[model samples]
Every structure is written in C-alpha cells, then in structure tokens.
Target: MKRLLFALTIILALNVALAANVDLDQLDIAKFSLTTDEEKTINFEETEYIITTDSITPSEIKLFFSPNNLVITAKKEKPIEIDLNNDREVDFSLTYLTNLDAVTTIELKKTDLPEDEMDDESSPISDLNPKDQVNDILASIKANLKFLVYAVIVLIVLIIIVKSYKKRANPERLYSKAEALHKEAQEFHKDGDEETAQELYDKAEELREKARDMENSEV
Candidate 1:
C-alpha cells in the first residue's frame, strides 16, 4: 500500500512538471513584412501560431495565435496575457505591433509571478504604474475607435443595400456608385493589378451608362 501511494505521488508530480508552455523560440525571423494575402506559421513545443495580413485592408496586419486551442486576435501594441496550462495563472504574454507599412513586430515574455501571487497582484488596479495606466487608456481609446469605424462601415453598407432594393432608380445614386468604382479601379491600377483594375473600370463605365440613360429618360 505504501509503495503504491509513493508511485502515485511521483506520477502526479511528473504530470504537473510536464504541463505545456507555448514556445516562440522557433521563430527564425524577429520581424517581417507581409503583404495582403500572405501568411506565416510557426510550430514550437506542440503549439502552432499563425499571423497574416488583412485581406481586405492592405495596410493592416491581422494575427491569429493558438495556444492550447485558445484562439487569440492580436491588436497593435497590445500585450495579451495568456494562461497556457489552464491553471488560472498567467504563463506568458505576447505583444504584436504593426506599422502603417505592414511591418510587424512580435514580442514574447514569460511571467515570473507564481500562480497564487498572480491573483493578489491583479486584484488591485492601483498597483499598475503610470505607464501601464496610460497604455490601458490608449488601448481603451483604440478599441472604441475601432468599434466606431466598424459601425460607420456597417451603416454605409446598410444604406447601400436599402437603396439598391428600392423600386425607384436614382441617377445621382448610380453616378455616386460609378465614382466609387472609379476610385477603386484607380487604386488597383496604382498597385499594378491591371486585370482587376480593368474589371472595375468596366463596371464603372456600365454604371455611368445606366446613369446617363436614367437622366435622359427623366428629362
């Protein structure tokens, strides 16, 4: 009976000691630039992390990291605390910062605080230093700004959808859509994507012709 108990204790200790810590040391490059539609993945210590550029926006880089099957969306200059082992303690932190040029920087740091001490340290907001407070404020502001931008985009899309469903055809509406298409085509042309640019240009010309027909019919 004594021998069995001792062996059980050792097994439990080993299991606790072998709990996984997501590693980032396998990343060969510290910083890299990714264009839209480009992605990079790295595997380390049985965990995989992936980062990619935003497909819709060429200037933004979006990152997806999975540690212990927990997906994380990274934001610029934000440090995300992760609990890798699911012990309700922070194991490490990862910060992703991106530039306007689509260059990204990754930072990984291991937390030194013990599991129990972490709870005590986090219980008080007054413990944070001045710099941390400022960072928190800035992050809050950025989050609000992001939400507002998304809301505006959604509103614009809703307006366009509603206007399209209406029975009356407005020449001004068609002209505005043609103008928007022309702007998009110009961007694609500037990027040297001639095929996409030409497609958009053709669509803009079609819209312009429809607008002219509507105007002549009304007159």
Candidate 2:
C-alpha cells in the first residue's frame, strides 16, 4: 500500500511540474479572427477591415487565440478613450461600459500578443518614442477661421462689384439718359418749336439733378 501511494504521488507531482513549465522558447503563433454571415462585412479602409453588427440576427463576434496564455477584455464604448499603437501592447481601462448593444462597437481584443508578427526578427520601428510617433493636430477653431475669412472676403468683393455695376447701369447714367435727353432736346429745337424746346430743356435739367444725386449717394 505504501509503495503504490508513493508512485501515485510522484505521478501527480510530475503532472503539475509539466503544466507549470510549458516550453515557451519556441515561437507560438496566435490569431484573432471574426466572421459575419448576416450580410455585415468589415471594411477597415486601409487594408484592414471593421467588424460591424448591422442588420444581423444575433450580432456577435468570434475570437480565436493560440498558446492559451493571452488575455481578453471587452467593452461597449468605454468611458475613457484609448490611444493605441504607442506600444505594441494594449492598455484597457476597468471602467468600460459592460453593455454590448451600443452603437459603436465593443472591441474585445487580446493585449498579450507576440511582439514579432512573424517568426523572423524584424526592424526597430517599434522602439520609437510615443510622442515622436504621434502626430500634432490643428485646432478646429483655427481651421474654421481660415475657411470663414476666405468666404467673407469673397462675399465682400462680390458685393462691391455688384454695387459698382448697379451704379454704372442707372437710368440717369451718362450714355443711357443724359445723351438720350440731349438728342431729344435737339430734335425739338430743330422742329422750330421754341416753347416746347424750353420745357424739354427744363426736363433735361431735372434729369441732370437726378444724375448728380445718384453720384453723390454712391460717393
């Protein structure tokens, strides 16, 4: 009985040791995949794809990982925003919204992934500083101010041009009214109607006054 009990105890200890010391020296390839058949496809725009749950019956995503050592976390539009790609690893907040039915997707991803995408070692772009990697963005007000100023200048120039054209196209302008009145007065004088010509001359003088008034208003 003692010998049998000793053998069983040795077997259990070896089993525990084997589970504890997994061979991690070799490269373990792991993947995270999602497939949708409910007519919602993922198009991430830049060779990558987005997984949407629109018009689907169940609206669920599947994840597959390898090595069984990775960790998974999920949230529906977490309260705090994340700035990814600074490091190869992801940092998720514990305060994420637990509800999965939000409009924006709930990203459940594996943070502990292999640093080397391939089995072979690669370049040192991954060692860059987070600030150096990040790009500076302009303020919204500054951008809108540029567009607004351009629009206002264009509007003012158009108004000035339109007002100038209206001034030149008046009924009492040089060519349209004064010249016509002069011709009419000359015709009346040539017809030997002196009294009519005097009245027409007065009318022409009134038209001249109107022209002067229009010019003064413009200046």
Candidate 3:
C-alpha cells in the first residue's frame, strides 16, 4: 500500500509540472495594424485596437498608454478605441503586457482636425428635421425593395443549382448513406422489429443499386 501511494504521488507531481509549463508563444495571438499610411502618425481622432488570444482570460492582459497617460486592465476581450488628444497633435505609445510574459507595443502620432471640418454643420443631412430624415430613409428603402427581391430570387436559384450539381457529382455519398441505413436496419432486426427492419433494408438496397448505376455511368 505504501509503494502504491508513492507512485500515485509521483504521477500527481508530474501532472502539476506539465500544467504549469504552458507556453504563451504557442497561443494564437492576433496581429493588428493601424489604418493610417504611416503607423508612427495617428491621423484619426480615435484609434482602435483588437486584443485576442486563444483560451486565455482577458483579465490576464494589461494595457499602458504613455504621453496621453491611460492604464486599463480588461475584464473581457474587446476592441479598445479611445481618443488620444483633442487639443493638438501628439505622439504616444501603447504597451500591452500579459501575465504569461507576452508583450506588444504600438507608437502613434495624432493629428489635429481643421476647425471648419470639425463643425457639425459640415454633415450633408444635418440641416434636415427628424421627420424629413425619417421620410428620406423610408423613401430610400422603398426604392431598393425591387432590387432586394431580385437579389433574393437570384440567390435561391443559385442554391438550387449548386444542390443539383452536388447530387450529380457525388455518387459515393449515396453508397455511404446506404451503408448507414443497412447498419440501422441490422439494429432494428436485433430489436425484433422484422417489418420495419425489412423496409429499411429494402430502402438501403435501392440506394445501393442507384449508387452502382451512377458509378457505372461515370466509367
């Protein structure tokens, strides 16, 4: 009994060691790139970053932003979008650190928007009232309804064509299906249902014959 207990203890120790040695590099970490032509320059007011990892909790990851000065520890994996600076152009760096010693850093420069371009009146539809905007949206939807109907009809036709082509192309599928039915029929026979089992067997045989004919035609 003592020998058996020692062996079990050794096995448990080995399991614990293996579980603790999980490599972060082997995990599926997503790569991200900025929308700007120059990564060092942040042309947009708001920047977005998507954090992703395989089987790792978001709480294990930490984010640190410098110059703009922001720190966040995520409770869940989601896109991080924030305004770096609203006054003028500024350069900042974002650093991501994981509990598993994985690190990622991104540097960006923000650009200031022109005063005229930043005005809310610059929007084309900003002058329209709420009722007029609703009417315009309804009119646009009504105008597109006929095109939407045509697109749906085309999609349905394509689906039917693809299904028919697959049925013609895959004669082996029928044989595999027939084999499954035969196995089920044998189970039904074992259960003492002779009538149902016979029907199933007959159907299986019919499918098998069809498959054979299709194979011969291909030859």
Q: Order the numbered candidates by TM-score, best leading.
A: 1, 3, 2
Query: After TM-score superposition, what is the CA distance of residue 107 in candidate 2 from its true location, in Å?
Result: 26
Q: Which candidate has the highest lDDT of all?
A: 1
lDDT tens per residue, model 2, 126-171: 4335653331112222323444565556556656766786777575
Model 2 ranges off by over 4 Å: 1-150, 153-157, 160-163, 166-176, 188-203, 214-219
Q: Go through the candidates in order and give each one's C-alpha lDDT.
A: 0.56, 0.39, 0.47
What tens-digit string does per-residue lDDT give for candidate 1 at 1-219? 235445655654443322222233432112334445555554444455655444323333345444345555556665678665568987566556555664455555546645543454323235567976676555444434544565456556655655665435677888889899999999999999999999999999999999898778767
For model 2, state the Cα shift of residue 171 in Å.
Answer: 12
Model 3 ranges with Cα > 4 A deviation: 1-164, 167-169
The TM-scores, one per candidate, come to 0.29, 0.25, 0.27
User: How does candidate 1 fare on TM-score?
Assistant: 0.29
Let me know the TM-score candidate 3 reaches against the reference structure: 0.27
TM-score-superior candidate, 1 or 3: 1
lDDT of 3: 0.47
